[model samples]
Target: MSLSPQFLDELRSRITLSGVIGRSVKLMKAGREFKACCPFHNEKSPSFYVNDDKGFYHCFGCSAHGDAIRFLTEAKGLPFMDAVKELAQAAGIEVPASDPRSAQRQEIQATLYDVTAGAARWFEEQLSGIEGAEARTYVKKRGLDDKLVRAFGIGFAPDSRGKLKMALATHGHDKLIETGLLIQVDDKEPYDRFRGRLIIPIRDQRGRVIAFGGRIIGDGEPKYLNSPETPLFDKGRTLFNIDRAAPASRKSGRAIVVEGYMDVIALAKAGIDEAVAPLGTALTEQQMEKLWRLVDAPILCFDGDKAGQKAAVRAGERALPVLTVGKTLRFAMLPPGKDPDDIVGEGGSAAIEPFLAAPSPLVRVLYNSRLSEIDRSNPEDRAGLRHRLDDLAKSCTDKILQEEYRRSFTSLFFEDFGWKGRDRTVVGDAISRTRRDIKTYQSIARSALYGCFRFPQTLLRSLEDICKIDFDDDVLKIWREKIVDSVSARPFLRDDGVIAILEADMISPPQKFDITRDLRFSLNVSPEVGTARLTRIIRFLVENEALSKALDELNHRVINDTGMGNYVALEKMRADVRAKIKVIRDQEYESGATDAEADKEELGGAAGQSAASATA
Candidate 1:
């Protein structure tokens, strides 16, 4: 027997077209449709196309075309009946038996749809009547004009329980109860399920009303009410405004999931029609799957309140297990104490546009949510954050994805909390050696440089003579120049004032060398010690150089000279030079240690003074 047209259409709608075609063909998303090399007869420029909205695949090269069933029958070489059975199984549909009652059941289901549709229209008519005056005012207060009200089909339920039952009495009370328009009890009469609330119809992909959502007008218990699960309405699997959102999503290349029907309506009113919402529940895996069919990763824009943030976290947790490659969610939270409606009211659509354009990815949202839950500086709390991250990554069934997430989270954790990597030991050792070398270099330079900056008055007279010496170290030369500049700018310098000059010049320290830390050694010297020590160090350095040069000249003359008289004279001058060199070397060695000891004893209080200075 042939399958019914209604069953075939339902099957087609259930199975995503691109997903079916992608199993054999490596389909790539090209705008709203997917493209692949034609499987029938491929010349390799991706002439095969699949459109989920159209629920079919077509090959432009060979003119081959079909739905999911036809593709299996033709491309996979399966028989027509086998293809139909396979697709039916995948779609969660049972093939109708040849028995006549199956057809009767289908007809009865058709009547239930008609009943819900009639109730929706009746509710819409009530919104325009005298009893709907309150709802109309609520709508106007929400800034919804006539066009948006008609577009979203906003309606009202009369406060009386028997009003809906009486208005649709022709559809029968039992039918209305079956369609979830009324509630039934064991012994009492059935009454309306929704009352004194603004009614919103929930539709399926084909735009047929399958359920209803109601919001209480004033302060009432259970501010929002949704229809109970029925044969046609599975709340977990259905999203509000999906029928309208799909085409808009395709055009804009985005799908936005919000928290409620009112939020979706608000977004649509702001000209952002690509918005949908789960039916009075946290987002489910089935709902996310439905969203992914429209866009690879949908934007989940939740409110900024604590409840909304908690809802976002719940959605992220639910999505972890089923998060496959190219399928995820982006999270966008409104500003504090604001929802889409509130934002639009204050600043119009442009206010929420930036948030929608750049929502955080799923991994970022999960990472940030866990991070926000704890104080990272507390070791126990930080450990908890790490454990939560690992747990989220572990929930993923995809091994590659799980490992990638683990690596990313570990890297981010270390970078944020100042943890080192495996090679830190080697790096530390090298850095220590470089620091020691820098310390030695700074020490040698500071011997002569510190006195000049600390007590410029003592050295100001010797400045011309000191600048005449060609110093071996570049830092000494630079320090000497800084001292001359400081003295010229200010006639007499205080110790603290001189140190400030040194610090200002050392702001951008040379790479691979840090001398500023040891520069504090100058505080160990008093003005008298600095002046006396500087004179000794500078004189020893200059005189030692002069004696060494004179000795070298004498030696060169002795080696090249031919007359004995000249050689004798040169030898006598060399001996005199050697005697002078010995005295200078002795003084240099003795003076450096003596000055160091004297400065240390005189400034044993230097550390305390430096601490006070630092506090100041």
Candidate 2:
């Protein structure tokens, strides 16, 4: 059965080679392809590889190679006709009958390939001839050398419409029109579609010319023109320079996407060859899939302009529904009012390397783009942003990936606003109690600093805790620093001596506070009290501050997350922190009371001794 070449091409394009082979062989994703143990020749390690982009399976172990049909015939032991019928049915395409007309159509399709190749050669010749002098000058002015011009198959279409028609007349006007080289109207003579323009050929995976893109040499309404949709060319499914970029991407471990073919060429001239561009359209799902077949995350290097950002957003949206675990995109933005061409042209590939080196992830780009449209300060606007982000995350077909995206978006949103929120009622009364605890901790910190100044000896033991204090007031911080320096310099300095040193350094001691006055005074003057009271105070302050921070984070999580399991977990954590703070406060109060009583007894003993001495 002789199937038409066009039918066979469609069959291969529609069927994914990995999907077919995966039915029998276990395939694992290897960058730009899938790998499995060679089924024909068993081995421990995987030497068999399948590339859906190029539509072929190869085995390094046994050197077995074929396409979808061949796989079915050899692996499944199906006849060639039976394999073709099976694939055609799966692809939802009708198998062409092996008749005289099918053979004739096959012959015509073969000739069409020849016609496009012939036209590409003719355009190249025109570029190097007298008629292309203006186009050649334009190319030179753009910094393209002769070597690059030939490497990219850069050519020219003359101003005269009939010239291309006459040059390729032997191929017949019908074939030329079918390949989109000549424009034909109803009952009208066909003429050249591209005239007075510089041509760049668009090729398939096999490096066969399928279409042409042209840029006008001078002022024109449409700055760029592309060949109309032909049997061999579908712009949405095609990318410029894909044939060259596929291998380059395999070596580089990534592919670079630009806004135009010219940008791709510019990077190529700068010795960066792993670049491709969408053909006159925003990137489509088909185009993104093609890129994923080359690398996990292709870098989309768009111009740093309004339109370019919009293009990136569109590409991101298109990719959301089909996203998998390992497949994604990264975005690179050029400097404002510049492009890859401008960067490479000015400073060679070095200038563009930085932008490509640290491209933003797709999620960040999407989140920021949506975030920029709303007023972050407004509650309603912020809620709207969350909703939009949630919707975007839910669009992913992969459930695990969807959940991860949700977490990422949520984390990003909270990071911008910080864990602080206006809700004081989070997790019942936890947030309200935390607010009060913050004030209590601040007062304890103040009292600790005041106590340190009075008894410089206490500072010697708790010097580490003293340094850990987060003083909000500059004056208090300065005072604390001076006291620490004085005490650290002389560990046995008395209260009056330390005070004198502080005064000498022009640092004022903290004003006495009534909040914990008895405990503070007893801590300094009474050696019977020891350093335990001051140590407990500092520890209480530190623990309270840490608790407040942890509770704040949990509060934010509990409020933002709707999952019952997570909410319950976060609530329990908040409860535990509140309980811990209560225990610390209780211990401090009990210890303070006992020390106050001890000071009173010491005073009473001194009074009795003084009275007895006076009486004698």
Candidate 3:
């Protein structure tokens, strides 16, 4: 908050606003200024013009205009600090640190991170030692060699109840539980994190070992076990081998995303280095965002099995909207009953390399999947197939991705069904294609909220990061901005408040319901520390007074813009805030009321009221 207008003006001068906006949005010169269609509002014409010299962007039609910081904060709805950091990184500029508390948390997480790396090395040492005969034999039988084992950090966790625990304890790692390395049953005895298992250390793209995945050595109830949610590891956010795979992904401009830790390891060992896998959980929007940092286009590569194909479809659905224009995605499936690892292990990575080399449209997969199940031999099946493809095409939100899918898919359908010529006879094809988007929107709905929650101090920063917004609709952007502003001020929410507020911002009731379900599922993951973690997330986003001011300004635009209208969204937001304020008001009445909580509440409520009044 101490940062003055002069300091901001100077900072803006040091960075090119066009270059910053160009990170996520493609910009071209339109005379003196750079012009691109307002990503914040859907338009056939370019109105979102960035005046490079002035270091500002103004969308005359939509009235969404701002500086480099504002672009980032609005585009992604990130916290103000987070947006600043994002832009600062893009500008190749250094951002000064604000609070020492963030530094402390980072340091603690670093220690836990080191512990994980140390444990992996220890496990690796055991496997390479004389006692690792069984572990060595198991991989060798699967076509992995000594080089592959070492490359993947393939190691054996001894079978004894407290073997690795004793090893780490001797090395002065008594706090293994906090590091998520040694599990304690009753605070009485520490046990090995992975017992008689094949250990696979999970890391971020930075190569920090934040968690671990252990594959059982023999027949076990749960075939694989991963580290529980820890401060250093959030299963939904981490990916396996991303750090090792990023260089290759950047060079290749694509990455092969797979199912398990071993899939990535096997692919890497087989000379396919651009492979990453989700860690101990389903692919999340956060993971997608993470992958976007490394590669422009990502290919979903699941095993050619029933479950894998299903997962691929679900993941692709979520990825489509987030995939920036010009950037693309494809899917690959190994032969049935075979995974990337299995195929590569049996016939070398060379055999599987061809599939990973190209991106295949999801429509082909969907079409083939549908055709194969409909008794293709029957004459009636041909008619049904034609209609299905048409309906599928119309449902797509992105024309470019859809058109590409259509071309490739039409070829396969003609060949498979033996139908020649462009005969577009699709049946039961509804004119308004039902929303077939497969992404459960687990994090996307909370995207606006989580933007604030993740970095409480800089709630407005996320919105400033994305130079453009592309929901393909103006009204939607209005709702999005309002939601971002209202949610950013929130320091933390009661469960019911969160549910109600999230639902208020969504396009439909089902979408709101989906968010509530998904958020609860993710939050319930770390039951022991859920409350503290949620509180911390809130504080991180709404970090400073300046951010709150910017958010209030942004929120007012959303509400006052007559094009957006007075929907239930604004009303619901008001009701939620008033109800929440009442609860705090009651608590203050009970306890010795402190000035701090009361004042922050007043500021937050006033911001919300201003947004509401603007609509009125």
Candidate 4:
């Protein structure tokens, strides 16, 4: 049985190559592809790779390479027809019959492809000719040059009902209508579907012109028009500029989904080649899946308007059911009333790169979108918000990721609005007191000292701040003096030397506490983190200590002072100190040290020493 190229392409597109190989191979994600030990040869290290974007798997050790069908045939020892049938069933598509009817249908589809291609060429010709003068002016006005015009196969549809019909008349009216080049009524003659507009060809993955999108050159009812779904084109499954963007995305390690064809072209013009667009609709799961084939997370660039934000949330909700561990979406928002085209035109790629570089993750977007709609002052409204978040998180089909989303949502909620429903005044006062307490500063200072002990270079780098850090614990204060004196003497003491100093003084590193785990982990692995980051962590600790002292002093003054003016002044000072502490903590969190690996073993014999000293 012979299979048409189109049918096979669709089959491959529907089935992820990694999902197929993973059933037997246990594939691990390696950047944009999956890697496992070579199944063809006995290898300990993972050298076999499967790329879903290219729809092939290869082994570096055994020199094995093939597509999904070839994998079934060669690796699983299945016949060609059997493998094809299995893939077709998995893709939910029927294996085409070998009968003459099937052949005829395939032939007609091939003819339709030719008709679309011919129409595209004719549109290109008309754009370069006098008929497309207005479209040409519009292109030039948009800062599109001749190279972009030819690269995108941009064309013009003359504002006549019969021009496209007459130009591609050789392809027959039925074929033209089938490809969506012309529209036909019950009794009236078929007419051109796109006219008086700038034409941009939408190509398939293989770079064949499958459809056309036309933008109105002048004032019109619908500003843009797209081809009706035909035998060759499914608007939801097709993305504009995907043929070019796929390889570009693989090279750049990213894929960008803009709002329209022009935005894609604008990004390309600005040297950003890895960009695509949905065709006149909200982004679909099919389009998103196609993007994931090229990159792990594709950035969805939407306009910075309420409508665009709503669309982003809708896209996120649509994607939740299909999201797996590594596959997800990020959202980038252009300035209000300004798109990629406007940004690129005004300031080139530089202006747009920052937005694309720092997109909010899908979970954050969902949380923020839902949070913005709630009345946080009302307890019932807050409860409703929590339920909505839970529902959105549960929408994810991946159980592990669903739980992760739930945890992330819960953390974000608590961070936004702390614990509620209790003795409101007592809880609020306790939380406020905790924020100003010396124990908080002690934890921070001890974590920083432990970090210095484990990574002595951090001690030298942060010597200035270390000398001034007022440790609440007597042992920590003495250990700090010894460390500073030793590091100041040698100026480059290794971890062993710092350990020696601690051992001589009968001091042990601070025990890890729940509140200081992030800071402690950050300090423990200070070598991996550069000096600048370690210094910032130490500086924040010092600043936090100062604020804690200021708050304590203000507390004492407020308790003793009887005058209203004096109490108000003291309370204001306390508020200012608390605000500074919050700012310091926020800065530390944003420095990205909080997510460092927390399971690293203590340096040298520090763990044993910590245990022995705890008992002492």
Evaluated at residue 288, the lDDT of candidate 4 is 84
C-alpha local distance difference test of each model: 0.75, 0.82, 0.63, 0.79
- lDDT-sorted candidate list, best first: 2, 4, 1, 3
Lowest lDDT 10-mer window, candidate 2? 517-526
TM-score for all models, in order of appearance: 0.56, 0.57, 0.49, 0.59
Please report the TM-score between candidate 2 and the true structure: 0.57
RMSD for all candidates, in order, please: 21.4, 13.5, 31.5, 15.0
Worst 10 residues of 4 by lDDT: 595-604
Can you tell me which runs of candidate 3 are displaced by over 4 Å? Answer: 1-96, 170-174, 185-190, 370-616
Query: TM-score rank, highest first?
Result: 4, 2, 1, 3
lDDT per residue for candidate 4 within 139-174, as digits (tens), equals 999989999889999999999999888878888898
lDDT of 1 by residue, 44-151 (tens): 588888989988888888888988887765564344665676677677787775678866776687788898889889999999999999999999999899999888
Candidate 2: misplaced stretches above 4 Å? 1-105, 418-616
The digit string of per-residue lDDT tens for model 3 on 319-346 reads 6555556555578767789898788877
Decide which is better by lDDT, 2 or 3.
2
Task: State residue 572's C-alpha deviation in candidate 1, in Å.
Answer: 56
- Supply the TM-score for candidate 3: 0.49
